[model samples]
Target: MVKPVIAERGGAAAGDDARNGERAASVRWALAGLSLCVLLPSLGISVANVALPTLADAFGAPFQDVQWIVLSYLLAITSLIVGAGRLGDLAGRRRLLLGGIALFTLASALCGAAPTLWLLVAARAAQGVGAAVMMALAMALVAGTVPASRVGGAMGLLGTMSAVGTALGPSLGGGLIAGFGWRAIFLAGLPLGLLAFALARRHLPADRREDRDGTTGGTADGTARGRAGFDGLGTLLLALTLAAYALAMTMGRGAFGPLTLALLLAAACGAGLFLRVEANAASPLIRPAMLRDPALGRGLAANALVSTVMMATLVVGPFHLSHALGLDTGPAGLALSAGPLAAALAGVPAGRLTDRFGARRMTVAGLAGMAAGTVLLSGLPAALGAALGVAGYLAPLVVVTIGYALFQTANNTAVMTGVRPDQRGLTSGLLNLARNLGLVTGASAMGAVFAAAAGDVATAGAEAVASGTRATFAVAAGLIAAALAVTVAGRRARPGQTADGA
Candidate 1:
């Protein structure tokens, strides 16, 4: 949610003043278009996971190559989001969104028709670029179109869509694959893209025009506008650091050997370089001033931790049910839905709670819930009855997910509220970057922890799976506990003390 520069009077009211009915209707349709475009790429991220086995068999690529199809999309989306958002500010968000939809739709077609594995991979990367554009532009469009008072509600909807799309991606893809084969999964985005494209063309408002006539409410022409640069050095360094580090983590301890060691070295060097460059640049990719705010710091960290727990549950929980408990895929999949469903159910109430109590209290409570849930999840053993086992697993997952949703909603609101209006686009980019990084970091780290535990276990059957599951949940609990501690300490040091002191 971008804070409007016109804070004394919100843009939505101004938009209403600009013209009551037609302009307001335009905003609604524009928001709907942006929302739909945002949904497709997020759906793509997880949808492919369900189709990977089918893809590998069809293309005869190595399993590792198949993994790149997922990794590349994550890498591109995570790395390019900030740049894309900046591009939207420099160019126009509406133009960028339309172009992105076109490109994305075309890329989906390419993916669906690829004759070989490499072509499909290339097409997926192209799709990632489009995804980045859509995601980066969507929020900015909302900020630009929606009135300030309604920004909260609008952003809440965006957040819900992102969360819901992520959870639904696998199930939706699974259904597509089951009914129509792997290609259908890729093609699924086509209709969505087309719909968004048509709606945006029909209803999205034009960019603010610069008039030369100097009429009643006009500004002079030839006013010098500062040129925005891409921070090429910072961008290069950040890309190297994030891509290399993320890949190294995902590759586990020794998968890449000497190359991994080299990548790690490069990542470290890149980080130092990025910091120095950003500090000196006229228009930096990330502003150093923004990091000084306690609100931004806490919000970013809390969301990262929340993301960590959220992804960890999704990555590890199902295996615990299916592999360790000998449940079939159908039942295991059903169990996995508990968390996301709980998250969806909890979002609205959580928002009102945040509005009433401020973010700090809600964030702390959420972490506490996650911690308790993780601890309980870690203690589950093999002797329980089916109903008890289901209850034990589902209950903790629901609690943690609900906590995560609340934490995310409150944290985002707090962060956006803390920043200056003009800086909202940059702030949104950074927050999202934190989230993607956290998603990759948590999943990789937790998977490594689980694998390490399983490696040390002496038993070769159900006992080993049990030990691994227990160990994973134990580590997850510790992570959530650490997250809780961070939240507590951060809240205490917040710059502005409200009634809730959040």
Candidate 2:
């Protein structure tokens, strides 16, 4: 009787295992859906870039000020990622991600309806906040749910989504603006956002790792475990400090007078306050120890410098294509699409290469490719044939994006490997912050150059914008060449020594 009962139990257990296996297979698709939800908002910002000139003409704002429609979103999104990531660790990632989609959708409506530039800017900032929350929390959720072996592939997929979204933005915006106007471009994500929110609520398991057995909300089964609580004060300080610092940089050449000085001081005070709070708190926004690694230091610098070059390209590319070549916004936008297209396609192969070869070789090769591409871009004659110029420009753009993809993927893999798994959220936030800050700095610096040169040119305004665009590219080329040294330093300082081994 006992043997028959035992055999029956074993049979039931096998059936249960088969069912669970089927469920696991389905989970992968659901995970991909959630990742796309996190992706679409940030992607929306870049997609609208092609419509900027139209937005400016419609609103009667200067081109420089109009550009902030994009810059403001990038600044807000990047700056808040750390705080958002910390919040995800404390609260639940799924809850935060769902909330982000809701907020992002609402903000998109506001942006679409904004009657003035000020309103549009405010809406864009709100959109950034939503994007930051989605980004940080989505990654946190992925880390919690996915098995270790597949995380790299999933991360690669996420990178591909990001690249695709960015690459597709201009064409999407161009089509929308040409058909219904720029407002349609802002409003395009409404249906998609709603769909994401619904899918997330239905599919994602709650990220609570708290023990069912009576234990404190601490590490259990070797997983990071924390209660749901937010450091509102720390969040505020960080936001203020970054916002103020960005404002000062964006204003350029003391354009904003005493306000810039006040902002700088406020930013400093905010930084000091954040350090105090973080040092004393039970749970901090970012761990100080994470930033102390020598490897991290080099990685951060290289990441920032590379991003700066990217932002410079974004700022200058359209003007060169439109004003210099006398192309319409559609053709110009298409020309600018090559880099991100190459980047998206390169991610999977880059990951495999990193695994096989290690980050050091890949980093050096990437930087060398970028430098070569930049040099090629800088040498084109002012009156070069349109076909030659377009081809030449795309060559560097593709090389640089591929190089960037390789470096970025390898660097992130290295950072994640070097840090404790419990602290991955913080590590990601810090890396993102460094890169975003670089973007802001690059945009502001290049914008200043463009503005100054525009005023100096005795030719037509279009010609002036063109000149500024080419000059900015030259400057970016020089900056990228300088960053190669930082890459070398990173190679030397890395630990554990896998592509995934930082």
Angstrom error of the Cα, residue 467, model 2: value is 8.4
- Residue pairs that clash (backbone atoms under 3 angstroms), model 1: 12-147
lDDT of 2 by residue, 53-113 (tens): 8988999989888988977887777668888766655555667778888988899999999
In candidate 2, stretches whose alpha carbon ends up further than 4 angstroms from where it belongs are: 1-24, 48-72, 110-123, 181-183, 202-205, 208-229, 253-262, 322-330, 355-361, 379-387, 448-478, 481-483, 492-502
Superposed by TM-score, candidate 1 places the C-alpha of residue 191 at a distance from the truth, in angstroms, of 1.5
Worst 10 residues of 2 by lDDT: 211-220
Across 254-340, the per-residue lDDT of candidate 1 in tens digits comes to 344787778778778888888998887865677676676766776777677667767778767766776666679888988887777
Tell me the deviation in Å of residue 308 in model 1. 1.7
lDDT (Cα atoms) of all candidates against the true structure: 0.73, 0.72
